[model samples]
Target chain A: MSRHQVRVLVVLALAAYPALYHLLTQSPVGVEAETLLPRMDTMVALLYFGLFAVSFDFISGYTGYLSFGHAAFYGTGAYFVVLVANGKIPLVPSGTPFMITLLCAGLVAALLAVGIGLVSFRLSGVYFAMITLGFAQVLYVFVRGLEWISSNPRDGASVSGSTHPEGFEVGVPFVDGLNLAIGPLSGDTVTLLGHTLGTNAVSFYLVGAVVLACYLAMQRIIHSPFGQVMVAIRDNEERAEAIGYDTFRYKMGAFVTSGFFAGVAGGLFAGFRRSVTPENTFYFLVTGDALLASIIGGFGTLAGPIFGHFFDESIREFLSPAGQGGGLLPYLQTRLSEGVLSAEVGGLTVEGFIEAALNGHASLYVGIVFVLFVLYVPNGLVGAARDRLGGPVTEKLPDRLWDR
Target chain B: MTAVADPALADAGLALADATPGSVFAASVLQTGFFAGLAEFLRPSNLAGVLVNGLAKSALFVMIAAGLSLIFGLLGVLNFAHGSLTMIGAYLGGLVMVVLVGGATGAWARLGYFLVALVVVFAALAVLGLVVEVGLIRQLYDSPPIYQILLTFGVTLVLEELVRIVVSFYGLQPISDWQEALGTKPAFLARQTTLGPVTVRGLALFEILLGALTVVGIWLFLTRTRYGLFIRAGSEDDEMAAALGIDVRRVFTVVFALGSALAGIAGALLMWDPVWGASVPLAAETLLPAFVVVIIGGLGTFRGTVVGAVIVGMADAVTTWWFVNVVTWTWLPEVTVFLILVGMLVVRPQGLYGVEEVGGH
Candidate 1:
């Protein structure tokens, strides 16, 4: 198969996921599939958040400048979208199309990146991370206290019923026929052929489309000559400078571009969820999640973080407290005999042990996996795959298999 | 200054302030303005209160940040799990206090038990630190500095989740202050005492005392002991220290243990304070400020940490005062702390005493 064939295959697989999930969950093997696979709603979250993580990797992994305050851009994008919809922002009408707001969010975040990069790019390594973090934290605190955003800003702002109550759309700015509203309840549903897609399924496709676009854009940049300089700067800043490349401008450009996509991701999040909080959007741990995704997926790979987040969200859903996605505890409860569950070990019943060890404790397992990856799988999943292929996977894998 | 010293001048100043504005003007601007707040802040009583509060905060800052600074100085690894370790210390300290202290126990005996709790927490966390350093951190010594950070960050996730499980299993709210632990505090420490014009919490005074003692103890360890000399030497140039036949690796292990021990002790202290009681989220809350303090002081310098703590503590106290009395913005104090960090980085990226290339490594 060719590289383009592989690309097409991947996109087709992603596009088919919701339909496949629907089909598999209702088949004779439904129970097993339901127990293992992530729910459609979780997949929707995975798409936008995966985009944020990919953007994080774009600058941090590619340029070797960890944008530790990357959440600031995400939070700005989210807040801008919500605020504009609520008519809180000046000049921009609340009736402004959702796509326009999202684009504006990206632009605003890109502008913010320029402002932050001006000061931040002066420092490198840990100092750069710390300064960016400081700036984000400053914004985080400011937003949390600003009553102008809401009656209770600490709780965050929501898309109010007074304005834009139908939900944010995710297509062309003015074309209603092309646009699809995205939310759990407020979203639009579609019936295609004999299959009827629910709100969540529709949202999954729409959000996935946006994420795919962002990914392709980032992938193009990574494969460009500009991206070569970014990698060069990461590998050796002095050498890049010696070769007459103005490393700082390239760094700033990369930062702004990543910031734009991160903002878009945030806007998508706000559009789907219809609410934004400082804790979820601007907090340092949000950046940590992106970092985790980048590390697990393959730090420098453009498409790696998405797969990384898929792994993350799957684990989280599998160990979720309520077992909303049919997790291990529920699966065990259905599979285990009464006597086996009641059997005692280490002063606790078998059921009790599982509850104590596995239930709602996905973070523990995820953390362990992350540590192991850092230690043994330092190159990450995609990077390791590339290593096995003896070069970039897209270019080398095809040659190894077909050309030979 | 004159208004603070002389009653007549103060009265005259008040009269002039009262005469200057309409009631509407006073309500809208003068009552909430910076100048009015500044005048009130300058009063001797308010000054004294803020001073004590600032000192207490500085003490806590110093205690939390000292270990982080020390470990980074030698290992060049910013221990992200330090705050989680401190959180564990709070719980362990609280556990010791809750188990040992009874309703009938006197304040002096409670104080003694608190000391015992501190020692127990320090020892336990030191052992844990030893295990982590030897098992996890040691393996990443060959990798880039970022790996160590990533490793410690993973450790934080595991530690916090484990704590959450235990805390919840024990029928306690992991997010809120553990009231049972707060109940273990001695009566004297829980109450307020007036010193002339200033009123201060007994816990604040105790914190200041413990903080000073900790500072003095670490200072003596660094300046007077052979191990301290080795640590200082190792921090400067570990390769050179190794060439001189000093066990640099052993020094790293020891400093890591010591740093963890300091975090534990700080957590134990925080457990007794009402403002920051034993809680899971305390890890991030304490961690961020500790980061700011360390960064503002320069990443790995002890003296700079102390100076940075004082600056941050004073700023926090002042902002808090303004929030309570002058400004209605609830995030003023918290925002000011981060702003200081940003301002400091822009002005002097190396920090007060940091070498320019310290973070580069």
Candidate 2:
């Protein structure tokens, strides 16, 4: 197949994922009261995170610059949107349209990224990582200190304001009645094609559309001539410089571009959750999550991290509690507690043992899986598939995935 | 070292000297008011307290960073689990304190029990290091640095969760119970003691002494032992050392063990103080400052590690003091370390003592 055919197929696949997942998990009951709604919600959330992971791969996978501070940009975008919506910013009025605020947030993040890149890109390898981390730390502290940003009005500014309280509406302009239901919204359900859809399901389509656009734009950028220069810089900066390309400028541009998309992802996240916080948006662990997704998906593949996160989120959801839509662990816990199995095992209650062994430890298993991947499947699943398929699949995969 | 000789100090002195009669009168009035706070802050005891605290903190950073530096130098592997090792040591020490030392009646007996626990902690971590090296790390010896980093990071997460699960299983909460169980009665370490114009805490003094001993001991071991020579040789060129019949694999194992032992000992000692006791979040939190220490001191250099730790610790201490007292910018102190790190990277990426790396990327 030609390259263009593969690109179109990838886009079609991307568009099909949410619809297919929604349909596959659909229940006989209306979607509003359906048990599968939570699962759909998770998949929709995965798309936004996939965008974040893709942005992360742009700098890290292509440039070989592992940014331990990419969360700085993500957090910037999140805070920007929420702060504007809250009427905290002087320039933007409160209850402004979500799209305008999101764009402004992306712009702010892009500008900040350029400044950070100028200072950080000077150092390479581990030093670059440390400095970027340091920059993020600075921002984290700075934001945490702001009394106005995180305080409750009742208890005054001293009350923790890590999460914004009053949720904002995300809606289309000129559409008076249809506010996009991005969360566990109340009231009536929207119906399409005689199928009832809950607020979260509607929000899923909205977020999925945004995520698709962002991914296409990013993929186009990665395949452009500018992307060629970025890959060149990543491979050999000195050689790229020797060729009179002004490597620093190229790097700075890539960094800003990455920051802008990361911001967009962050904005989507804030809108979906209807809240943003330093812990959620700005933490180094957020960057770590993106890094994990990119590595597992196949770094530099652009589209691979999307699937990587899908796998990750699905596993975590499966491991979650029953009320939260988990299956295996929760089922086992219920059976043990109900005396469906022997409570006593070597004088230890089976239920208690299960709780002790598995309660809140799913992330630990994820970490272990990450290590195993790094050690054995360094090129990730995409590369592994190409290798196993030998010829046909290899030819169809992105050039960057197999280029090295 | 003279106040007048320092350019900034000279400028300040000149400004004071240039004060007009009216300004002098105003200064005298202000001295009793705004200047009073400054004068009290400059008191010898207060200044000594800050430096002592700074030294104690630096000692902790140095201990953790020393282990990290040693591992990185010897194996070219940046072990992200170094913090996890330290945290495990702390938890084990806490158990020893609660289970063993709790049974002791006398202060002397308790002290002896604590000392024994430190050795046990070191031994346990050494064994852990051996297992980790042989079972997991050995397989990735020829892998890229990123793989080593990711593997160690995975170890860190797993170890942190394990610590959490184990601590909870023991029916103990972090900070309060762990600290009460681990520390000695009379709580001498946590209490401040005054000596004439200087004031210091017992734990701070102990930590400083321990830090000094650790640095000296490592130096002597490197300069005076056969194993140390082999480690240095292997670190320089593992293939060459192997060719020379140095048993490089054994050296690598020993190096990892030694590094973990240092972390274990540090963790055990830190348990002496109630404030810095090992907690799960600590394993993750310590990773950055440890890296900052390694980078600022010049990676893989022992002297550089010590210097870097001291600098970072001092900056933290001074900033905390200033922010709390002088400016009241509460958030600024927490970030001062990162600012210093960024500044250092921008000015000198090789660090103060590091040789310029050829084709560094």
Candidate 3:
């Protein structure tokens, strides 16, 4: 298949996932499928967060400038949306459309990126990362202590019932028919083609649409001449400068562009969750999560982080304790006989062993995988796959398979 | 917002101010204005207290950052897992103290036990450092410096989670300070000591003494010992040092071990302090401040780390005092530290004692 065909195929597969999950979980072997596949709600989270990761990759991966304080932009975007909706921000009314709020969020984040980048891009490597982190941390602490954000700013601000009782809408601004409200509690349900989609499914599709739009926009930039300069800057910045490319300007541009998208992702997150917290949005760990996704997916590949996050979230859900999402522990409990479960081994029963080893300990296993990935699979999943295929998946895979 | 204009507002403000020790002055700053507040804050007692607090904080900062600076100097790897090592030390030290101390144990005996705990934690953490350096960090020596950071970050996640699991299993709250461990402190260290016009925590004096001893010990080791000379030589130019028949790789391992040992010792010290006790979040809390200190001092320079720690510690102290006495913002202290870092980077990216092209390598 051609590159475009491959791209289309991937999108089709992603589009079909929720439907496939729904059908598979209802089938005879539904329990097994449920144990493995991520739920619709998790997918919704993955879409927005995955967008953030992709934006992270756009700068750090493509240009070799690790924006360690990338969470600042994300937090700014998230806070802006929530604050605007609550009518806490100046000029922007509470009843303003969500789409406009999201746009403003992105623009504000981009402006922040420009301010940070002017100072940061002067340095390289660790210094750049540290400076950006310092800026973000300052913002994080400042936001956490702001009394006007809410009665308790440390816990973060929520979409107040007095202002935004209905869920934040996703679609054309000021058009009720086109826009779909998204939240677990307040989201809209839809019926089409004899299949009823629940709130989560509707949210999944709407959020996915926004994520797809961002991805396509970013992908276009990556394939442009501007992207070539970014890659050049990454490979040999001195050489790029020697060639009179004005590498600093390109770097700033890339940083601002990525910051904008990250903001959009954060805005989507606020819209869906209807709440914003400094810990979740502005914390260094938030940036770390994006870094993890970028690394696991394929550092330089624009589309890779989405898949990487999917893999990560799946693992987390799989190892998560029973009840919330189907996991190994819950699956084993129902499937294993009582005698086997109680069988003693190394001073603990089989059930006890599983509980001790795997229950609520997804981070341990995820961390191990991350370590292994860093050590061996340094190129990450998509990068390794591309390496194996001897070219980009889109361009080379079909040629290799057809022996052309 | 106008405190003097409205009686109810004034009363509420006064009540809020009276709720905390230094807030009366803060309320006065609001009621009486900035100059009067400054006059009240300039009192000898307050100044002396802040100075003492700053020194004690600087001592702790130096202890935590010294190891990180040492490893970065030689290996050019910013060990992200350094904080986790410190955290493990806290728990390990706490474990020793809790196990050794009894209700009948005297203050001197408790102090003696703490010394033993420090030694034990240092040794154990040193071995861990050795294992990690030889096993995980060694593999990524040839990759980009970013990979080294990534690898250590992965290590941090694993270590924290493992600690969490064990802590939870032992029926301890991983998020809060281990109160049982706090209860193991010697009575003398927990009490206040008056010196001339100023009164300070007994623990602060002990910490200052320990801090001084640590500085003297490390200084002697770095300046006087053959291994320290080797480390210095290696840090300057490893290939040249290797060509001179020095085992650079072994030096790297030694530095990594030493750094981890230092972090562990710091953790042991923190376990006794009430403000920063043995907790899971302590890793990030200490790690960030350590980073700020190292960066402000210059990434890998010991002298720079010391200077950086003092600067940050002083800033933290001043901001904290202001938060208590002059400002109502709760995050002022924390925010100031990061602001200083950002300001430092903008002003001098190379840090106080850092070379022009340190991180470039």
TM-scores, one per candidate: 0.95, 0.87, 0.96
| TM-score, cand. 3 | 0.96
Per-residue error for A146 in candidate 3, Å, reads: 0.5
Q: List where candidate 3 sits over 4 angstroms from the true fold.
A: A402-404, B1-29
Which of 2 and 3 is the better model by TM-score? 3
Error of 3 at A314 (Å): 0.8
TM-score of 2: 0.87
C-alpha displacement of A394 in model 2, angstroms?
Answer: 9.1
**Which sections of candidate 2 miss by over 4 Å?**
A1-38, A152-181, A186-189, A333-337, A389-404, B1-37, B174-177, B184-186, B236-245, B358-361
Q: Please tell me which model should have the higher DockQ, number 1 or number 3.
A: 3
Which candidate, 1 or 2, has the higher lDDT? 1
lDDT for each residue of candidate 1 in A236-326, tens digit (9 for 90 to 100): 9999999999999999999999999999999999999999999999999999999999889999888789889999999998888855768
TM-score of chain A of each: 0.97, 0.85, 0.97
Q: 2 or 3, which is superior by lDDT?
A: 3
Compute the lDDT of residue A17 as modeled in candidate 2.
56
Spell out the clash pairs found in candidate 3: none
